[model samples]
Target: MAGPIVSRVSRVSGANGSSAAPIFVDVDTGVDDAMALAYLLASDDARIVGIASTAGNVPVDQVCANNLGLLALCGADVPVSRGSDRPLAAPLRTAEDTHGPEGLGYARLPSRDGTLTDYDAATAWVKAARDHPGELIGLVTGPLTNLALAMRIEPALPRLLRRLVVMGGAFDYRGNTTPVAEWNISVDPESGSEVFTVWSAAWGLDRPTHLPIVLGLNLTENIAMTPTILSRLAAAAGSATTPMSVLDDRGSRSAASNPLIRVLEDAMRFYFEFHFDQGEGYLAHLHDPLAAAVALDPDLVRYEQATIDVELTGTLTRGMTVADWRGHWGRQPNAHIGVGVDPEVFFDRFIARVGPYAATLG
Candidate 1:
């Protein structure tokens, strides 16, 4: 079968009437990560400049493969760079149980055809930011290892980029990993701490000026991929017909056969089972996709300024995100944490944008 079909749409400017946002994505490339990539690729409002892979949902090697495959499926020309293989201070752990053995359920993407960039992830990050100073938006959907390493290499990385959006952490809610810690932050609390604290000092600006926008589980968990939405998406992809079933200029397999939709359906079987086991109504939270949405359109969710930090040393609560919603923490706020979302709006837009792309694939 062909990999997936992708069709180009007329480009649309963002809310500010500016051109498509230039974004650099750091991912672990799990199922939701694949969805996030699809959303970004299908949207005319996002221009993915680069992808940095890290260890979270799977090993860094697998993450790299997943990213490369997704890019090929979408016919995107973005660069993919390898990042940290493990956490900065914690032992490496992954969510294979949730994402399946390949980290994408049953979907086995083709092997990467080209060589990775000469620069490592840290260097790639610095170069991308330096090249597009004040124009790049960094979106991280995995552990913060790559971002932390980039910060170490370029002390001004955070300041160089226009904004940072993270899809991790759990504020005042039960965590998916440990009792208190979310998967991404728990995977590397030390790196998370570094990311939340480095930007302001790197920029030498007031805390509010460079605060990272954190999309924690508290907000993302609300944007679930319910059966209704999935069914609608599958119906759209299955029913739609398109030409161009052959390879394209990028040598990517044509998606006109709806291969991408079939792959997503296969992948979501495992995801749905996992969520069903968790009593979540066979719904997988669209965590990373929602974060991607917020990166391009900030108005999808409401945010609050807070002093956020990851717990490094709590016997039972290690890796928990300490979001100081109250003014108890004397320190200035360094993060704008997402506290709420409009699920109806999010799902409506998500299905509308992502479903058609799947349909166009062969």
Candidate 2:
């Protein structure tokens, strides 16, 4: 490891000279999840304390490999933990179609064996929460199996964390995984439902808990990444390379300089190809990255409080998220469901941070 990304990104202190905020992330290492991790690595305000690899985009072991390789590639020293390989009530489903074979699109990470911690993922979350108490911000860009299981082990988890940001659900928008389900939630509805039910109960506890900011497809799909954005990203990184186009050969690799930039570009190219095949133009919806940004700064998106719950009994609507926006449920709002966002603003921040960060690695 030449240099650590955490050490390279200057920490932005608070008015009183406090250090950067501590963040604990759980992910499936989807292409967008990789982008999300990169965003965190670039942010001066974020200090990733730990990472958990969950099964979703790929198998849990594959996700672990992706995470280890990415961290090793960036010279990051954060601890990595392995999580559940299947859902609570259903068999695991992988999204190879969306994120490619390795869950990183066409890009393959530099594998790092024995990178996983001896302690499992649920232990990692509990340790982080107990260690940081009210200072740890949790982010889940994959299925909620790990976090939910953690809650079962330590029921006071909701009250211990400062906040949480989940990238799941579809709200009123159409689902990408099914007619009524989003990918993450659809992957593990039992865990997702348990998380919401338990988190909502925390509102009335002795130590009131903050509702998680859940960024569903409703708000995330709005932040699309097209070839134009990629071109701007490359220029921002000072990588003088051929810009990608729709006419480009499918599964083509990136021509960026050696290391992180090339891997990221290749990964995004696969994402672009997938979206194009789905008739979504040559653009990718960066759902996980948007959630990552929101974790660092909550004001990035406009959110509405909702008593959220996942449908588990309905055969057709199972895994569907039902957000009670009008307080019909009379239950405490479990999540701050995102409803609005300015894509240009997010892109501006993303390009500004990620581009310069990649250039440093290059």
Candidate 3:
């Protein structure tokens, strides 16, 4: 029972002569989620307003701690709020195997000195959206529970925001969590379904109004973090001439002087091992980071209109994202699905921005 679709193009830049692009991110704070936060923090064009932590890769409390730790590492004091402890309609299930025990792989971040905000995630999300109105970009890299709760509190939440970008689902690619389901959506299918349905209604799917952009496995899988890219980042981090070196106030030119870069490198070692074991190459898919990039610049990836729905009940297909690519359902196109991405372009921007932040850690 959502309202009419609010048709408008996403504007990444500020008006005339304003500041950077205002962004509010929701995350489960896994390794990839850490990469996404680092990317946003390092981007001169993005001004992170707040972060809502939800349960997915880890428990809600752990996710909040991880987010706070990441923010502390980047020297960012953005408001962080704890979100839903469990899914709307399912028992909490975590992905410890994929993200490690603490959800950060081998990377261990220091405890944040700053305390979390008084406002819970749902309130924080609604308030940020209300304050920014059409200026805030919502980027979600976890389960849809927090968003669903916010939408429930404010039914007109979709129309009140500028745009929504979700990093979940699998349109035409194999799932990473299950044979037919993506981790985020599969973690909480009911919440995911609620979000998709309400969001689709908010932006007239049938008539073609504003549509939420979905960066699923089909597109994100194309961007991988290979050893070659890691080597380049390490080189950049160690160079005194590079911006990354500026993060080391101690004037240490060595990459080891940067705690952030070291932590990332350590985390990636575990991630690389995981991927190698799966025979998926010696690279980890940059899933959440790619979604974050698309949020900041939609043109980075090619999109196609599609009607997307979440499967709620099927013995083997529960939580599967059912994207109607063939028009069999004849449903309205709820999502602008990412079908292609320029890996070179994405990595160049990612390294330029995120590499520095990672070098700043410690």
Candidate 4:
């Protein structure tokens, strides 16, 4: 592929000025996934340790291509890996409508060399947990198929990681792809069920923080994507695209600007168009990015530890998250339920963080 398009946006140094970014991401290369990846790669704190591609937003092959394309756009040097070709038990499905035919909207994609590391998505998960042991953060922004497969192969999958942050399941909110089923879980309920049961088991670490799954539900759905946020993102990208930008305190504006702004603009535009075409009242939601944000800064949301289950048998409730909010069932708290988020604070930080990096996109 040709070199990435350059920009002049200021890149956000690592969140705490730490040298190493410690996140491991698994994606299906959805536009939303690409945005979350952009945030991670652009940030100085959240380094890209590796990438594992799965079949969700697109076929396994296309997902790999999309991953490379986005990585190239961000000028990321992280290693890439190909994950599971099929779901755990059910027939595989893809979100062609939401993610487009390429899983990344209409953006031109990079050619694949079939050279990605051949790690099973689940095996990669197991190994990530083992390598980082009690300190690794595993962020899942796609269907739970790869994760389910990993647990099946290792059985102790949940115990392998420090955290398993997911952007799936709906509770106390309506679904996006179906009346009751969220797109990710509904795409593969069997895998979803397997994940719930495996993670629910208290066989590994003594601390409850060891394997708490962050449910999306009401947490991210209604969070609007405002015009102000869009404009800021676009401007950040525009500044990057322009020439003669000076290096600032954040980083080298000329060096990191192009990648940052282009990424932010690509993400914001795709998000804006999707919602606008659907007449979603001229705003979009940061569904996947919220998951990433929560991982980077949990203060963005107010969470409660609870026993959550994915309902698979109900005709109108399949893929729904049944959160034990009140402890009425007396079940052990298996995961963390994000019941509420501070919208204003989240939006402020999100824009502030993304805006500077976007300046590089131009």
Candidate 5:
């Protein structure tokens, strides 16, 4: 259901400065995505105006369900809409085993049949940009399918958006889904290509200012989900399990002891168990949240300008993010590439931001 539009900037800028922009999030609800949503809701620097779900960590249907469930858990009022069923080019591939059957680490959600905006997801995205013209920040935490659709439907998308921040591709690190291509781009390289070509050409903004796709594996993998963070998450799991409890359990309980811990315990234990079985132990990569973090704070990452294009035809290299970082091709760089992150400080800030949200998960 829609919540009162209490001035997007005021709601997000709570205690931080009052210059935060309104955010439009497109997601595929994995556990990390759930955490990101909670973090954004908690932050004073972001106002999540809307959410569009796509096919990625799980099927489109399940992702939508997860999105609504997570928003409801936060007691948020943002609109949730269904997006593209498949990528703009290739067939859709979902990470069922990784996200579990429900795409939320099998976190049980309530029967919250909330109403969404009447507009289609693509139309809603363009409208959000148009209504606020150059004031909206597009935060894409999943594949670029819905965004490609928006560009196709609204030919003036370049003029509508202030900035488009995406989570995909790879420059130096090994890919999570393949050796060369990251999971989001590999799912639909054509969409990634379309976004890069259209936004870069249509905006006429400075070379590195038009469209920025935050490469996942390269910048985020190092921001591991450490045990200390998991323990903090475990302590905060009560927020995800209140529907099962009566009023006796409502408000002002000792946070150190949470009922939601049972679910977090199961999810994290399962997550670590699977990774450990593969010999990686408790360490799991930070794939999507770090991308959202870039949108929230660009300084967390060190960027280098580059010309980027996706390989759509190569049997072996298809879906790879072919970046021209050294200007060998003699063309203007289309986008900025994120090459490095302050590992210690990045994780430290991430832990500080997400620790409270993880506590809410229980």
Candidate 6:
């Protein structure tokens, strides 16, 4: 069942009508992360100012390589930077089983001469915020480590950006990583806690009308990608590929003519298999891409304001996200928790934006 598609400025302009929405991307380069980055690169309304590679789906080193390589593949000249290889307080753990080795599933990127910035991810994040103060839109589809670190050095970080969108947590929903915790937050609960804490504090100080919008598992799991959707995307890109099917072999690869479509098909095949093996279905939840979309267009999803907190002490619920509604906690609402979205509308946007972009590439 689909949800309502709220209407808002899908593409925002500068106050002086001079520039597109300046966005800063922080990602773990998961398969979905790749999809999200591609979506942003394709959006003419989105101006990607910088990218911060974080450690989640894979190590930060591989994340940076993936970011740089993806930018090169798309022929987009975007600056990529590296963040912490490990979590702020926990030992680093990766999701190679879910996203495959190197984070992009079975898809291989072409050799690229693109390089990372000399500064670290934390510095990159702070610098981007400082450079585009009160205008930068921060999108994090990975762990909160880099953002939390940046917030520490620059306390005004929460206010520095016009808006922030996060793709993590599970507001009383089934967790992808554990029985009660989401993968990104479970990877670094302390950092997740830090982000909410600092964001709430700064937001309280400034009292900005827009709160941080967070898309958690409760909502994201509904936006799933199936084989049929992939076929439509290929058709839109004018690529002929071996159609994906449940009857296909477990490790089948894509044969799309277009390079971008081929890579996405290959990557999504693994993701589909991962979910199917986990008893979900022959579909993959497009968590990150939805976050990327919501980052540019908040109207894609209906959000409810709430005070959200991360648990760090429970042995079994250390990374669990707890949302307080009805003023139970006596604190102001700190985040806008996404509660509804029309997957069809989102898929339509994805196909229309990415398919043509893919068609333009080799």
TM-score of 6: 0.95
Query: Per-model C-alpha lDDT, please?
Result: 0.79, 0.87, 0.82, 0.67, 0.68, 0.89
Score candidate 3 by lDDT.
0.82
**lDDT for each residue of candidate 3 in 159-272, tens digit (9 for 90 to 100):** 777778999999878888889899999999999899989987776633353578888998898899976687677656663223222122321232345677766766666676
Task: Return the candidate ranking by lDDT, descending.
Answer: 6, 2, 3, 1, 5, 4
lDDT of 2 by residue, 296-338 (tens): 7877888776678999989799899998777776665567788
Q: Compare candidates 1 and 6 on TM-score and give the better one.
A: 6
Name the regions of candidate 4 deviating beyond 4 angstroms: 1-21, 110-114, 203-205, 237-270, 358-362
User: Candidate 5 residues 43-147, lDDT tens each?
Assistant: 667778888887888888788888776666556788988887888867889886666678765356665567666776787788778777766778887888888
For residues 1-362, write the lDDT of model 1, one tens digit per residue.
Answer: 22111211122243365678889999998999998898898787788989999999999999988898877776668899999899998789999989989899867676676557878887888989988787788899999999999999999888677778999999889899999889999999999999888875665444354568888899999988764576667666664322211121221222334677756655666677778778876668889999998888877777777778999999999999987766676666677788778998987787788878776665
For model 1, how big is the CA root-mean-square deviation? 9.2
Model 3 spans with C-alpha error above 4 angstroms: 1-12, 15-19, 205-209, 239-255, 358-362
Global CA lDDT computed for model 1:
0.79
lDDT of 6 by residue, 1-362 (tens): 12222323234456557557889999999999999999999998889999999999999999988888888788999889999999998899999999999788888988767988999999999999999887899999999999999998899898788889999999979888889999999999999999998898887845545578889999999999999999999999989898899899877788899999988988999999899999999999999999999988888998777788999999888899998866777777778889889999999999999999999995
Candidate with the greatest lDDT versus the true structure: 6
Tell how far residue 267 is off in model 6, in angstroms: 0.4
Candidate 2 vs candidate 6: which has greater lDDT?
6
* Candidate 5 displacement at residue 315 in angstroms: 0.9
Model 1 alpha-carbon drift over 4 Å, by segment: 1-18, 204-209, 238-257
Ten residues in a row with the worst lDDT in model 5?
3-12
In angstroms, how far off is 96's CA in candidate 1? 0.7
Count of residue pairs whose backbone atoms collide, per candidate: 11, 0, 2, 22, 8, 0
